[model samples]
Target: MQPSHPGMTPYPGQPFYGWYPPGGYGLDPSDALVTPPGAGLGGWFARCVGAARRGWRPLLPILVLTQALPAAVLSVLVLAVDPSARWDAQLASDSAALPANFWSDLATLLVVVLGGSLLLGVVQAVGWAAGTWVIARQAVGESAGLGAALRYGARRALGLWGWTLLITLIVTFGFCLCFLPGVYAAFALALAGPVYLFERHDPLSRSHRMLRDRLGLLLGRVALVGAAVIGFSLAASVLESLAILPFGTTPLDSPGTAVGAVLTIAVVAVLTLPAYLAQLVGLVVTYAEQRAHEGPVNAAQLAAELG
Candidate 1:
């Protein structure tokens, strides 16, 4: 027997969620723990936190492989090719003009960073898709596992990566124009990933509309998420810097110290786990809230769309 509700019928076997808002699209508040039924900021926060709690199990392994491990490897490569090794020795000898290998080292550093970032873009694409899939599914109480998410990631990686690249270019172009523009671009596109994952059409226009229509709400929410991730990364970076200090500026000078520094970088990478979780959960939850505001949407619809 289904419980009677005006204007909307609960899903079969689905427990009745609380009252629907006058303007809500039939999604009961109880359909999702991670997505409130068009709830306000407080609801968004609650769902964000709840999604994180439910999805962390899968999110962790996905982030560890696609984000943290790659980050550690990239750091090791950067450190290994660092021109600072020569600069450190030169400074110690009181030579101040320029290290002989400065340009060469700097060039190597640029190449390493550029190349690594390009490749990292690919893996990060996988992470974003997989993470979103897991979170959205979990929000709707669907069964989602690490293997399934990874597989989903592979399937969506290409199209999502292209969008990711487009968004990156948009931000880059904004930066090229000015700092303020860049920040604006970032906040506007902050929800682009989740939008693309769920909507799968005209993401750029859709995301921009969401931002334009609800500027303050979206901006504030994204800012909080951005702040959290940046703060965590900054803390991890500071820790890495402090940890490698014992090895001095030229941490790669000795095999023993080099290994230690590498280990420190790896640990720092692992420390970024929460940042990944925050970014995924916060953005997805925020997007869901935005959709709820726009029309009738719930965790199950989102989960189905994510597929």
Candidate 2:
């Protein structure tokens, strides 16, 4: 066996000479202990799962508060403001005597709903940025606390948000053109977050370039991770509904029922956090795998470079 590179650290019980160059070994030992020696779809999934297991402690809270909390809060607010029953009551009663501010009330509700949606987007952006930092640290066998992750994410929040908006617009435009083009565009730009956070490069163009010839592998890995997230999310939604069933039959009608519904949603948010973490881990692994294919580099090396 050849000697390991000067800066490389061999895993315990693994000889220094056993260390292979970036793409040569398939997966980096420092990044993934269980993944096989190649950066294939299965290897990527294994690495992601391994990373999630190892870094769940720090990853969970950040994901819950940043990604899930805002969403759950907004959902509860929307449910509370639902105007269907109220509108129906007004219609049945004297239509001419409808409340003076009925239209104004509706306008106010619309503004609040839109504002809540915007806030949720901002929170998710921060979460994604910070989560990326945490994953980068974990990939190199390092640990970062929630505070450090949040701080790092705050610094990058604006950039990440802008990137997200740009990508959304582009994808939306592609969809406007045709469904197939939109799907193609979405898959092609999937690496924008990782590329933006880690490489500090133009994520849109860089992600497209990195995925130029590896579309099939990227899509397969994404589909696997996406399916898992969807499954977990559906399960969480079902559980949330069941949990809130005891609150009351008319959850939207009373203060007590509303409070119970909100709490249930919050709990559900925390429960489904793992799904978000899994998706993040998969993306990080996918980014590292793509980098390996592009050149002779491993996760540790990428992490070091980002640092």
User: Candidate 1 lDDT, tens digit per residue, 106-139?
Assistant: 8889999999988888898899999999887787
Tell me the spans in candidate 2 whose CA falls farther than 4 Å from its real position: 1-30, 33-39, 91-106, 176-178, 238-253
lDDT of 2 at 260: 81
* Model 2 lDDT, residue 289, Cα: 74
Instruction: Give each prediction's root-mean-square deviation over alpha carbons.
Output: 4.5, 5.1
User: Candidate 1: lDDT of 212?
Assistant: 97
How high a TM-score does candidate 1 get?
A: 0.87
Task: Indicate which candidate wins on TM-score.
Answer: 1
Estimate the TM-score for candidate 2: 0.80
lDDT of each: 0.80, 0.73
Q: Report the C-alpha lDDT of model 2 over 1-307, residue by residue, as the tens digit.
A: 3323334443334332234554354434445622333536666667777778777888888888888888888878877766655766777786777655688778877977988877777788888888877776776578788998888888888888888878888999999999988877887888898888766777898888766767777788777777878898999989987998887545868888878888888889888887898788877777777765554455555555445
TM-score of each: 0.87, 0.80
